[model samples]
Target: MVSWYDPLVLAQTGVRSIISATIGSQADRRLLDALAAPKVEPSDFSVDAAGRPREELWLDYVADMGDGWDSTYTIAQTVSRPTLTLKDETGTTHETRGGEVLVFGGDEVYPTASVGEYEERTVKPWTAAMRGQRPAPHLFAIPGNHDWYDGLVSFMRLFCQGRHPAGWETHQRRSYFAVKLPHGWWLIGTDMQLESDLDEPQVHYFQEIAKRMREEDRIILCLAEPAWLVAQVRAPKERSYLNNNLDFLEEQVFGKKVSVFLTGDIHHYRRHANAEGRQKIIAGGGGAFLHPTHVPRKESELAEGFTQRKTFPAAEESRRLCWRTLGFVGHNPKFGVLTGLLYLLLSWMQVADLREGGTVTWNLGRVLGAALVNPGVILLSALLVLGLIGFADARFGRGRWVAGVLHGCAHLAGALLAFWAAFAISGAVLPLGSVPQQLLGAVLVFAVGFLLGPTLMGLYLLLSLNGFGAHPNEAFSALAIPDWKNFLRLRIDKDGRLWLYPIGIRRVPRAWKPGETAREPEWVADDKDATPPELIEPPIVIGLLHPH
Candidate 1:
């Protein structure tokens, strides 16, 4: 369990300073450029004091929407271990002093978010983390792609008041809701399923919210997935939010210098500069599986500097704020390579002493002679060896060739070991017909049956589970295990810039521009073809996502 990484990072004299020297100033240029864009044509788009789109009105007035409410609250209340703290970028501990809201990205349950999924996988762990915690944060969330797998009913019920014990619904509103925060902060939450259109009622609700923002002083938007991050990672291939013209909302609100966005789902934390000098925080790493660390694309940075697309330079400036900090930090702890090597060495030592440790001695010469004379035992052993090898190959191997070889060896070795053990035990014991002898025979047979059945069953499952004509790669690929507990958390800062703090790492990547990574959806043939959707009705109200 020796850790090598601890010293490696500690040896550096603050890599942040080194990285900054190599890069330039961290100011956002995009926000400055955007301020020069045309002024808000309020008449062209009917908006309320809040500046929310008018087509989306019903959602604007939800119990959560207001100057000081957060409909979607994202809480990283749980820790992977007993020692970790559930804190925010400001080191505000959430273990007891709960925030008012919570948000989710996707895969709330590891692989898929099936109905009642949380009951089996996450609810207990989450509850354990909050046991006796003083205050509890209200929860709100949106459906990510993983959440969409089982149609989100399970997720909706767990958070929305449909089930209990095995459920986590703390309120009555559907999974996604908007809450108005104090001091003109309007928190808008929504599903990231861009393919589906917002229902007419919901659309109107959001529009009315936009109208209100026009009159408001500030707004923060909370979304499960950081559409900005997705745009950077999967540029030219929009994930969800970006596909729905959320970028356009950024452009409209850029001059306001008051809107901030809070997002999660990438499983990494990031802080980026908004074109209007606001902060965009990505708090996606909260006990969940970590994602690849990313750098801003060169094209994005060159096209619009650090404004819309946050570049590394902007991150350097972000760190100077001093309010940012991590709730927790961890490493794999055990060096996997070293651990594997030690285990292998121990296994080798055990195998070397196997013959000497066991008090059994076999008359191999006589047995071989007998086997040569009859040949049946040898033939049976050969067949068993082949089966054992096949099983071994499946269990230990990776690709087709290695897997086949290992399985074949395993089957052979298992049969030989069983035969030898049974033979030695039989030779040392009494003949059958006695009470003790019969009992021993029964027990031995049962043990052998138990061991052999699994070998046989495993081979059968391997063969039968794969559909005809399916590639072995595809069949075996899915059999690989996946980590079920990848919890991520996100939070937004006061400046509207995002600060992403992964639970495992203290250093975060530099933020990218809003549109630098913005990609036109696949449905849109190309970037040029990806025009803002034409509005037929009175401008739909879309509330700005509030930073929690």
Candidate 2:
């Protein structure tokens, strides 16, 4: 698993994100998807039993996986099994088996999407879990932003081809696909690419699928991002384009047949439902860092009449976890090392003579004046201010610039104080030689920087998230909590009723041992350490069995 908090990892991801965004804007990849292969027919996905379309079907949905081995493998193992008997909050038992179709909603691999990453983080673990399983499930995936880092090359090669990633069969001809399910139900996965705009080819592709649908046919629309949740947070002018695209599809393509908006990318489980019985679910917790559920206000609706009904890690628990940011140094020592080095370099650049009449003297004014005059220090300072401003949340609008400036100034002030304190303390303790005092002061400065810099950064992130509703992704990714993971299981019964089971894993096992048999997951959670999965809520029944 990539340590997101590691300074080098953060730098690499940031660069990749910038590059991908730039490339996506200049060259649209979705337009090329049609040229890659012929559009798949909607009827291709109908589940068949005894050479006929079955009236009942079971399907599994997971996303934001391909991280740490233990967490990813744990989820893979659980979902790959033949049967899972779990209990709901009311103590009622529910038995479910692995889905005939496994849909990875988005972000199959983390850090960046590459062939190597997919093989190591996704394919290997899944292959291990599904080894020797019979009647392999059909697999489908939609590309999230991370997957588009490589322009969907790796994503297409892994999922779009009619090849098996593990024991599952991949039948989708393109990144986006339409699956015809039993009882006039359909599963449509749309690839929004980096930008949320759907290409003309994709629009026509779905429109073609729509022509075959009856007026009563309901859709389980799978998306990479939950545009509803995004729309709630961003301003109207800056609202998600994905939501707009869905609106177009609803208005022109499928009408009001979309019953469920299934998505991942948030790395947690949340459900919202409107009065019309339509559901919008975010179940990204396949296997990634846990994101906080408390960031979004309780009173806010995800969409028109769609109020949040369930969350896996309750808001209270999520709020409690925010305190973990205080231990930022322990969580990300490598990041701290970067900050420490930066502080030391800045301090060294501003080091004053501090020698007077055979005694080491501390002078803040002298150090500040020296730093102000130094061209290198001035340039570094400017870069620091600009970088911090750029790092501020864009959602904050102009306020982000103000916040970033203040934040940068605070760091500069803190660095100055640290330098002064280092010299003062060293001068007071060390003997009267200028060289010895300077050496000792430099050591103290580095020590203080290493310890205090990251702690301050953590506090800043925590305050930004809690106080200003900024840096939600950064704050939680820093924590890297592996618990509170979840996924979804959907079953369309013979009666045509759609049942959704949201399963939650409170804690993933930290230890693993090799399985002795081929039928078992190659790496099984140690029996003593295993935490069984349970339903986050009772099964959510969507749409009437027989609609008028």
The candidate maximizing lDDT is: 2
* lDDT over C-alpha atoms for residue 508 of model 2: 91
Off by over 4 Å in 2: 43-50, 132-135, 235-240, 298-301, 352-360, 365-375, 395-398, 432-436, 527-530, 545-548
Clash numbers, per candidate: 124, 0
Model 1 agreement with the true structure over 1-548: per-residue lDDT tens digits: 11212334223323433432232123322123224322322111124458753332111111111000000111222221223344443545542212334444444554444554455445543453344443334455555555544555566556654354322335424544545543344556655442333433344445555665546445556565665555543435344437454644445432353355666565444555534445555544433433323233333542122343322213333223111111001122222222223222222222212233443233444333443444444455456445444433232224434444454555434433443444446546865234464345345533553445334334433442231211222122222211111223323333333323233233221221122222311111122322221111111112334432
Q: What clash pairs does model 2 have?
A: none
RMSD of 1: 20.3
* Stretches > 4 Å off in candidate 1: 1-97, 162-169, 194-200, 232-244, 251-258, 295-299, 302-548
- Please report the candidate that would top TM-score against the real structure: 2
User: Could you tell me the TM-score of candidate 2?
Assistant: 0.94
**What are the models' TM-scores?**
0.42, 0.94
lDDT of 2 at 422: 89
